[model samples]
Target: MSVSLVLTVMREAVIRILVVSGPIVIVAMVVGLVISIFQATTQIQEQTLSFVPKLVAIFVTLILAGNFMITTLKEFTEYIFRLISGM
Candidate 1:
C-alpha cells in the first residue's frame, strides 16, 4: 500500500486498540490510586493490597467490556482485510 494508506491503517489500529483497552486501563488506574491513598492513610504497606484490587478491577472491566472489545477488534481486522483485498 501507499505511504498514506499505511499511515492511515496504523492510525486506525492504534485508535482501535486505545478504545478497546481504555476502560480497563482507566479502571485499573482509579483502583490503584484509591488503594494508594488508603495505604497512605492507614500505613498498611502490604503489596498485595494494591495488586489484588487493581487486578480484580481490571478483570471485572474486561468481563464487562469483553464483547465491545471483541467487536472493535473484529471490525478493525475486517477493515484491514478489505484494504488488502482492494490493493
Candidate 2:
C-alpha cells in the first residue's frame, strides 16, 4: 500500500480503538473519581473500596456497550480486509 493509504488505515484503526474503548474508560474514570471524593470526605482508605466499584462500573459499561464495540471492531476488520484484497 502507498504511504497515504497506510496512514489512512492506521488513523482509522486508532480511531476505532478509541471509540470502542472510550465508554468503559469513561465509566472507570468517573467511578474512580467518585470513590476518591468519598475517600477524601470519609477518610476511608480501603483499597478495595476504590478498586471494586471501578471494576464493576467498567464491567457494567462493557456489558451495556459490548455489542456496539464488537460491531465497530468488525467493521474495521472488514475494511482492512477489503483494503488488503484491493491491493
lDDT of 2 by residue, 4-60 (tens): 998998999889989998999889889999999999999999999999999889888
**Per-residue lDDT of model 1, residues 1-87, tens digit only:** 689988998899889989998999899889999999999999999999999999999988989999999999999999988988997
- Per-model TM-score on C-alpha atoms: 0.96, 0.98
Instruction: Using TM-score, give the best candidate's number.
Output: 2
Candidate 2: residue 36 lDDT (0-100): 98
Off by over 4 Å in 1: none
Q: Give the TM-score of candidate 1.
A: 0.96
> Which portions of model 2 show Cα errors greater than 4 Å?
none
State the C-alpha lDDT per candidate: 0.93, 0.93
Clashing pairs for model 1 are none
Worst-scoring 10-residue span by lDDT in model 1: 1-10
Candidate 2 residue 66 C-alpha distance from true site, Å: 0.2
